[model samples]
Target: MKELKSEVSGFVVSLEAKAGDEIAAGQVVLLVESMKMEVPVEAQMAGTLEEILVGEGDSVAEGDVVAHVREA
Candidate 1:
């Protein structure tokens, strides 16, 4: 499984996938809000969505694993 990480340090805005969702290479998996801006967290590769490590309303740092993708 490949990790899907947050690029910015911020609060989670939304999560679009649950465990076992089929995901594409560039799909938007989650959204984060930082500095009054919304940032998208996209998948690194095509796969089935695995665990969502963080819940909405949680704070995260850069390089933090937000979710996982089991490679297709």
Candidate 2:
């Protein structure tokens, strides 16, 4: 399993993938709003998105694990 981490401190603007969804490496799992900009949080490797640790509107810091992905 791999952890998808946020790149910046921000609120979760949206989720692009749900649990159990197949995700590609570099695929945007969610968007984070920081300084009025939307930053995509991407999966580091292709895998099944197993869990989303944060929801829309949830605040997250840099490097926070936003989700978990199991290698396919």
Quote the lDDT for 17 in model 1. Answer: 80
Q: What would the per-residue lDDT of candidate 2 be over residues 1-72, giving only the tens digit for each residue?
A: 888899899999999999999989889999999999999998889999999999999999999999999998
**How high is the CA lDDT of each candidate model?**
0.91, 0.95
Query: Please, what are the lDDT tens digits per residue for candidate 1 over residues 4-43?
Result: 8899999998988888999998898999999999898999
Which runs in model 1 stand beyond 4 Å of their true positions?
A: none
Clashes of 2: 0
Per-model TM against the reference: 0.95, 0.96
The collision pairs in model 2 are none
Off by over 4 Å in 2: none
